[model samples]
Target chain A: MSLSKQHELHTRRYGRNVGVGLLLVGVIAIVFGLTVVKVTRGDYETPATTTVQE
Target chain B: MTDTSFNSQTGTYQTEATFGDYFALLKPRVMTLVVFTAFVGLLAAPTPVHPFIGFCAILFIAIGGGASGALNMWWDADIDAVMKRTQRRPIPAGKVTGDEAFAIGMALSAFSVVFLGLATNWFAAGLLAFTIFFYVVVYTMWLKRWTPQNIVIGGAAGAFPPMIGWAVATGGVSVESVLMFCLTFMWTPPHFWALALFMRKDYDNADVPMLTVTHGRRATRVHILVYTILLAILAVAAGFTSIGGPIYLSVAVVLNVLFLRGAWQIWRRDEDMSEADNFLTERKFFKLSLLYLFAHFGAILVEAGLDKLGWGLWA
Candidate 1:
């Protein structure tokens, strides 16, 4: 292959690498984000309030 | 019929290796240190990360370190072939092509940084990205061929892993992170110079301008001693911080004293002596250098444990 063609191929390969990397990151992020949202929400109710004599 | 033709033909076959061959290209020993130190950084941070995020951060950092090694091997193939220590490395030995190594490195580098950023935070991911770039582009491609100071500046790339780990948890830099960086940065010159002193012939044959090659063995000896003093000071100082405690202080004191003594032995030697005498000193110091960093980082983990137990001396 010509040097330019070789360079082009490598560049394309690098792009593919980046794409895979992004996909992995996206998968991780979705799971993490969902967990964070759930944790922060009012899904777990506060303990029932107890009255004390003044 | 000519040597050039034979060389070109061999180059064509350099990519023929199986899975194990590529695995060897990652420089596993260095990766181990990177992973350990980065893990320590993550654990030592004031803020806590979800366990899963923490694990992913460390995994990405290890991959980033491996990526740097792969890229370094890709760029340094010529010198690697000439050096006895590196001659059997995948690229140098024709087990992998430069293109293949480059591809693997670039791929891993991207994967490590981007995923780490997403799984944890962008700050850590950005640091990983820069570390890969600095090691490959700045250190390997530009500096290695051009200057004797390559390792000194390039050392920052290696030092950044722990800092990246710190960022993963805290999402920013702090005094503790800087201290961690200083420990590795200061440790590097002496660690590498000792090896250079012993492997002067390799550098010379490869025409790489290591300190020993450019300034003579005496200068390299003095340089090692100087860096060792600096490293000792930094190591002990680290023991006084929030990250430090009785365990780390004790570990640092013992390791630093032994390291200084080793450096003194290396410095005391005359260059005109036989290889049996001189090489022995360099070899011992080089081995000690590896143990030195391992112990120092291990001490940091100990300190973190003490802190968690509410029994830290420094705290």
Candidate 2:
């Protein structure tokens, strides 16, 4: 293969790896953002006890 | 190694870096400890973290730990080149450049910290950032070459992960988290010292001021005993904390006894003993030290699990 072609192929491969890594990061970030929202809004808080009267 | 190719067009040397090389820069083994301890800390916290949040926290903390390892490798490349144990590391072995390692470390450090802050809380992120700084700056750059007490003081960096995990769950620190941190912190000196005892020549050749190199093997042995005694006290005492219970206490007691016996064996050795024999005792102690921390943390994890089941001792 020509030097330019090899260089181009390398560049494309590198870009692909970075793209995948960034995609994973994006997904994790979204999950984290949702969790943060849920936490800050007290979604995980314990429910108040309701006593039953006979 | 750097695979250089003749660029018939530009005629410049270009380094061919690989995925494994980059991964090696992260020091995955150390990252494992950081991740596991942090996971335990998060689970053992009073408030439960959302599953997704917990996973994100551990992932980011591991990244932070890896970043620190890369930065450490970057700075310690010189000593690493001299030492037998680290001579084949990416940088020293000519696989990765110092600049490349530094850039990766800095980028990952910033990425992990920022994303962790967004994922969990700024408190945990801050602790992660401090951990990176302490490992890279305090331990690698400043202390490792300058003082025999490097591991003693610098162990705090390794000790912070569990606390950060706890912070991820509660957005604050507590006595439980502090005790967990103490467990790792106190365990650090003797662990490294035992390894140093066996690998004394590595520090000597590198001219790093490890206690073994600075104070002689006898003094190092004395230090090990002293630290192990102190560690035994701390490790067992940690069992009584809120994070600890019958399971943790039982594990801690047995592990500390074995650990103390190992330290005593090392302490009792005299100069007349063969290097091979000394190496055996030190190597055994070193191996046990690894299990000592893991079992302690594992026991804490079991206690946390039992707590969730309403079967914990305190429950």
Candidate 3:
């Protein structure tokens, strides 16, 4: 069989494969969105009110 | 890869388990209840969460709940196959194997817990972990088949989502969260016993020791009435708590009256009478139970909304 030929696994289990593919994409979107929100809210920033005097 | 198109032993197309079948293993209907209660819990809290955070919190909580459901299905496949209601489940129907179910359950369990902890507070994550354990290990494994009081104690597992939701906001338990937990806990028995009443002979054939199976049908009816009365008290009293307001109290009072009336009607009938009427009252009560929980939570959500608008009684 040629390398470009579609495997039976892909064709037979199309729904399962597509579902998993979409789920992976959804996970990426959620993680990216959460990161953006956290960054914008300064959830990880050092406290501005704190000071150290030598 | 290797002729993964058939279930040789079952002689069915099990290997081709679709996305829907895998989803079915999660018991989506039960997940709806979990997600709704968790959302109510999160929104009802005094602290406001970021919208995205709140959404993620509820989603993770629901996935964790579904993971527990999958684990329960894996563990209870034998009895599930025997029961008419559960016979079409993925495991029982031969669409998925027990091992696959367990794997999915465990993977999702870990993913949901870790992400929930990262997204919210560890306290809420811990509660989710415990809820999963209680449902799978304690309730399903130990309590369900061993005793007829299974659903009574196992009700705690279903009742924890709201508390977990509250923790997502407050990072700890509180009187209001406990009240929400109590509402669901007190409501589970009558709801399930009604199911057992109408779905007669299901538990008997499964040998699962449900109240209807272990106790006589008359005893089941009496138990339903007693539990209904107790549940009405709890549901009504919840309206006076911090989570409650005028709207909640009104909804609670009306629903409890109708619920108690349904239970009373159920209590007055014998098996012969129930059979003659096709278990109409029991079935009706069962349907009403769904509306009962949703309305109570809906009322609470409304009161929370009203509080935001400064129109709430306690505002």
A-chain TM-score of every model: 0.50, 0.61, 0.74
Which tens-of-lDDT digit does each residue in B1-315 have in candidate 1?
Answer: 211212362353443455567777789989998999999999988887777668777878998899899989988888888899998898877867788899999888988887787677788898999999998899989988788898899899889988999999999999999999999998898989888887768989999989888888888889889989988998898888888888898999999999999999889887665276758878988899899898888888888877887777787
- The candidates, ranked best first by TM-score, are 3, 2, 1
DockQ of 3: 0.78
Q: Write the per-residue lDDT of candidate 2 for residues B1-315, one digit (tens) a residue.
A: 234654332233444656777888999988889999999999988898878778878999999999999999999988888899997787877767888899999999999999899878899899999999999999998998899999999999999999999999999989889999998999999999988887868999999999988889899899999999999999888778778888888998999999999999999986566385667888999999999989999999999999988888864
Off-target runs (Cα >4 Å) in candidate 3 are A1-4, A47-54, B1-15
Better of 1 and 3 by DockQ: 3
List the candidate 2 regions with Cα displacement exceeding 4 Å: A1-54, B5-15, B271-274
Per-residue error (Å), model 2, residue A4: 10
Report the number of the highest-TM-score candidate: 3
Better of 1 and 3 by TM-score: 3
What TM-score do all the candidates reach, one by one?
Answer: 0.83, 0.87, 0.95
lDDT of 3 by residue, B34-124 (tens): 9999999999998999999999999999999999999999999989888999989998788898899999999999989998998888999
True contacts kept of each: 0.00, 0.00, 0.64
- Evaluate residue B52 in candidate 1 and report its C-alpha lDDT on the 0 to 100 scale: 65
Using lDDT as the yardstick, the better of models 1 and 3 is 3
Q: Which candidate has the highest lDDT of all?
A: 3
